[model samples]
Target: MALVELGRFNRNEAHILIGRLDSEGVVAIPFDGEASIGDGSYLFIAVRVLVDEDDLATAKAIVESAA
Candidate 1:
Protein backbone atom coordinates (compact mmCIF):
# COMPACT_ATOMS: atom_id res chain seq x y z
CA MET A 1 0.00 0.00 0.00
CA ALA A 2 1.32 3.41 -0.97
CA LEU A 3 1.50 5.87 1.93
CA VAL A 4 0.85 9.56 1.65
CA GLU A 5 1.44 12.36 4.11
CA LEU A 6 -1.83 13.55 5.62
CA GLY A 7 -0.38 16.30 7.79
CA ARG A 8 2.56 17.48 9.89
CA PHE A 9 2.28 17.94 13.64
CA ASN A 10 4.30 17.88 16.82
CA ARG A 11 4.81 14.46 18.45
CA ASN A 12 1.98 14.84 20.94
CA GLU A 13 -0.35 16.30 18.39
CA ALA A 14 0.55 13.49 16.02
CA HIS A 15 -0.43 10.90 18.61
CA ILE A 16 -3.76 12.63 19.19
CA LEU A 17 -4.41 12.69 15.47
CA ILE A 18 -3.42 9.04 15.17
CA GLY A 19 -5.93 8.12 17.84
CA ARG A 20 -8.61 10.14 16.14
CA LEU A 21 -7.93 8.42 12.82
CA ASP A 22 -7.83 5.04 14.50
CA SER A 23 -11.33 5.54 15.87
CA GLU A 24 -12.48 6.10 12.30
CA GLY A 25 -10.71 2.95 11.06
CA VAL A 26 -7.98 4.86 9.30
CA VAL A 27 -4.48 3.59 9.96
CA ALA A 28 -2.00 6.39 10.37
CA ILE A 29 1.65 6.39 11.49
CA PRO A 30 3.79 9.15 12.84
CA PHE A 31 7.26 9.42 11.38
CA ASP A 32 10.24 10.96 13.18
CA GLY A 33 8.48 10.59 16.50
CA GLU A 34 11.16 8.37 17.99
CA ALA A 35 13.98 10.42 16.60
CA SER A 36 12.72 13.50 18.36
CA ILE A 37 12.56 11.87 21.77
CA GLY A 38 15.08 13.07 24.44
CA ASP A 39 16.45 15.92 22.36
CA GLY A 40 13.96 18.18 24.08
CA SER A 41 13.51 20.03 20.81
CA TYR A 42 10.84 17.72 19.55
CA LEU A 43 8.39 20.54 19.49
CA PHE A 44 10.57 22.22 16.90
CA ILE A 45 10.56 19.18 14.67
CA ALA A 46 7.48 18.39 12.66
CA VAL A 47 6.17 14.87 12.91
CA ARG A 48 4.80 13.47 9.71
CA VAL A 49 1.45 11.71 9.73
CA LEU A 50 1.07 9.13 6.99
CA VAL A 51 -1.80 6.99 5.80
CA ASP A 52 -2.52 4.77 2.83
CA GLU A 53 -2.92 6.68 -0.39
CA ASP A 54 -6.35 5.21 -0.98
CA ASP A 55 -7.50 6.61 2.37
CA LEU A 56 -6.04 10.05 1.79
CA ALA A 57 -9.30 11.83 1.11
CA THR A 58 -11.09 10.35 4.09
CA ALA A 59 -8.12 11.00 6.35
CA LYS A 60 -7.87 14.56 5.15
CA ALA A 61 -11.54 15.12 5.85
CA ILE A 62 -11.19 13.66 9.35
CA VAL A 63 -8.21 15.87 10.13
CA GLU A 64 -9.88 18.96 8.73
CA SER A 65 -12.99 18.30 10.74
CA ALA A 66 -10.90 17.98 13.88
CA ALA A 67 -9.32 21.32 13.12
Candidate 2:
Protein backbone atom coordinates (compact mmCIF):
# COMPACT_ATOMS: atom_id res chain seq x y z
CA MET A 1 0.00 0.00 0.00
CA ALA A 2 1.13 3.52 -0.73
CA LEU A 3 2.06 5.74 2.19
CA VAL A 4 0.43 9.15 2.43
CA GLU A 5 1.09 12.14 4.64
CA LEU A 6 -1.37 12.72 7.48
CA GLY A 7 0.25 15.89 8.76
CA ARG A 8 3.52 17.58 9.68
CA PHE A 9 4.64 18.22 13.22
CA ASN A 10 7.74 18.44 15.38
CA ARG A 11 9.37 15.14 16.30
CA ASN A 12 7.74 14.80 19.68
CA GLU A 13 4.32 15.72 18.45
CA ALA A 14 4.68 13.39 15.49
CA HIS A 15 5.62 10.53 17.75
CA ILE A 16 2.74 11.30 20.08
CA LEU A 17 0.34 11.24 17.20
CA ILE A 18 1.86 7.99 15.98
CA GLY A 19 1.23 6.44 19.36
CA ARG A 20 -2.31 7.68 19.39
CA LEU A 21 -2.92 6.28 15.94
CA ASP A 22 -1.37 3.00 16.93
CA SER A 23 -3.71 2.75 19.89
CA GLU A 24 -6.56 3.14 17.46
CA GLY A 25 -5.08 0.40 15.23
CA VAL A 26 -3.67 2.58 12.49
CA VAL A 27 -0.01 2.17 11.64
CA ALA A 28 1.82 5.45 11.20
CA ILE A 29 5.42 6.58 10.84
CA PRO A 30 7.51 9.71 10.90
CA PHE A 31 9.32 11.01 7.86
CA ASP A 32 12.29 13.42 7.87
CA GLY A 33 12.48 13.18 11.65
CA GLU A 34 16.28 13.06 11.69
CA ALA A 35 17.02 15.55 8.94
CA SER A 36 17.09 18.54 11.24
CA ILE A 37 19.25 16.85 13.88
CA GLY A 38 22.37 17.46 11.83
CA ASP A 39 21.75 21.21 11.83
CA GLY A 40 20.72 21.39 15.48
CA SER A 41 17.33 22.82 14.52
CA TYR A 42 15.25 19.71 14.96
CA LEU A 43 12.56 21.52 16.89
CA PHE A 44 11.99 23.90 14.03
CA ILE A 45 11.85 21.25 11.34
CA ALA A 46 8.48 19.71 10.56
CA VAL A 47 8.38 15.93 10.63
CA ARG A 48 5.79 14.35 8.40
CA VAL A 49 3.41 11.74 9.77
CA LEU A 50 2.64 9.08 7.20
CA VAL A 51 0.03 6.35 7.09
CA ASP A 52 -1.16 3.76 4.66
CA GLU A 53 -3.20 5.29 1.85
CA ASP A 54 -6.06 2.99 2.66
CA ASP A 55 -6.03 4.14 6.26
CA LEU A 56 -5.88 7.85 5.47
CA ALA A 57 -9.48 8.69 6.23
CA THR A 58 -9.60 6.76 9.48
CA ALA A 59 -6.27 8.20 10.56
CA LYS A 60 -7.51 11.68 9.81
CA ALA A 61 -10.58 11.15 11.95
CA ILE A 62 -8.53 9.81 14.85
CA VAL A 63 -6.12 12.73 14.73
CA GLU A 64 -8.82 15.30 14.36
CA SER A 65 -10.76 13.96 17.29
CA ALA A 66 -7.68 13.98 19.43
CA ALA A 67 -6.99 17.63 18.64
Best by TM-score: 2
Root-mean-square deviation of each candidate, in angstroms? 1.3, 0.8
lDDT per residue (tens digit) for residues 9-67 in model 2: 97888999999999989999899888878889878889999999999999999988988
User: 1 in model 2: Cα distance from truth in Å?
Assistant: 0.9
Model 2 global lDDT (CA atoms, 0 to 1): 0.92
| Candidate 1 residue runs with Cα over 4 Å from true position | none
Q: Give candidate 2's TM-score.
A: 0.94
Q: After superposition, which runs of candidate 2 have C-alpha atoms over 4 Å from their true positions?
A: none
- C-alpha lDDT values of all predictions: 0.90, 0.92
Worst 10 residues of 2 by lDDT: 36-45
Query: Model 1, range 1-67, lDDT digits (tens) per residue?
Result: 9999998898789999999999999999889877766978767888999999999999999988987
**Superposed Cα RMSD, model 2:** 0.8
